[model samples]
Target: MSKEKALAIFTAVPRTHNCAQAVAAGFAREALVDTLHDCGGGRAPEGLCGALHAALLMAPEDRREELRKRFAAGAGSVYCRTLKQELKFPCAECVRLGAALAEEFADKPEIR
Candidate 1:
């Protein structure tokens, strides 16, 4: 999918539960969207607030793993890692949603 669309999906992830990690995962767009929907759209029966938060700030691709590893090594939970330790979340949701926005669009011609 295009970068804008990918970002739209990622940005929308936190509106639900707050797991930004999904946005940075190496998974497919559809899967990530579905996961976000489940968590944000009042469909996450189990719920994953922290994961949703981290995914929002994640890179548009698989690079989020690096953040995940960092989180794992630095903090015990994803929320604590990014919010308390890294202090990356500069938004009300505890994460800087779309921090990698430029990188996700880099190297690619503008869509449309």
Candidate 2:
């Protein structure tokens, strides 16, 4: 995942992509994006987080949990609304974190 690209997508005007969509799309492109949207529900509350989880569903349980923990540690919450309202976490930062984490785990043998 390209952090720059994910950030761009998350911060884009009109904001078509959410944090999950940006990160998933950055790493796996259309396939992941489509899977996320289909599985996670497009633009629903916490949809991005759901998409992230869905994207990594096939990975080992520990790896999936680690990714979730990483996201929570960085964004304060995986949910967009909570991150924004309670933690004041910026969408751009979430996108960056998501992208960076995805990149870190993308090549892992157990991530598929």
Candidate 3:
């Protein structure tokens, strides 16, 4: 899917789905949505951002790491609370970044 579509999905969600879920579900190939849907919320199993967790689930290890590094560099941290509370990172910005990363992953078949 396109980055714009991913961003739309991320921002258009009606409820409080986490960034991880938004990114994962947004860029997921048709067959992967059901599995990736579970990756939403504030903090995932190990206190990771939902977007990061979802990326890990959807992408290969190397791709997931790349996404983590890129997200941390751009957003200052992968944690949702830190991004929203301490840094005051905008949700739209996060969604944009996540969508961009998801697009990168979506474009690479080896990464999926």
Candidate 4:
């Protein structure tokens, strides 16, 4: 899926996609989307932000921590509650950034 289409899915009205769904859908990971259904709203394992969890799921195993670090550097935390309540970062924007950062893994593209 194209980047525009991915972002559109995340921003769709009536909001079907959760943070993980939105991020996974961005990279055409339809299967991941289903598995992540219950992972949003701070429910991800270890309290991970759903969007970051989905992005890490797509990267190489050895690179997951790196991706987490990179994501945290941008968002100030990898957990949903921190981002939502403490940092005041928005979920929609988290999905957008998570998908964009994950794209860098697939295409080796520089951060946009």
The residue-by-residue lDDT of candidate 2 on 1-112, one tens digit each, is 2767777776789977656677666665776676555333225444445434533553456687788887788777777557667778666676677677766666675534
Clashes of each: 16, 0, 2, 0
- Residue 31: error of model 2 in Å? 2.0
RMSD each, Å: 9.0, 4.1, 3.6, 3.1
lDDT of 3 by residue, 1-112 (tens): 5556656777774853455556655665545445555555554666656666666666666677787888899889988778778899886677777777766775776624
* Predicted candidate 3, C-alpha RMSD: 3.6
lDDT of 1: 0.38
Q: Across residues 40-84, which tens digit of lDDT does each residue of candidate 4 receive?
A: 899999999998888889887767777899999999999999999
lDDT of 1 by residue, 1-112 (tens): 3333334544574443233333433234444544454343222333323443334333435455554454344333344433443555433232233323323433344445
Pairing residues by index, what is the TM-score of model 1? 0.29
- As a TM-score, model 2 comes out at 0.69
**Each model's lDDT:** 0.38, 0.63, 0.67, 0.85
State every prediction's TM-score relative to the real structure: 0.29, 0.69, 0.71, 0.90
Q: Candidate 2's C-alpha lDDT?
A: 0.63
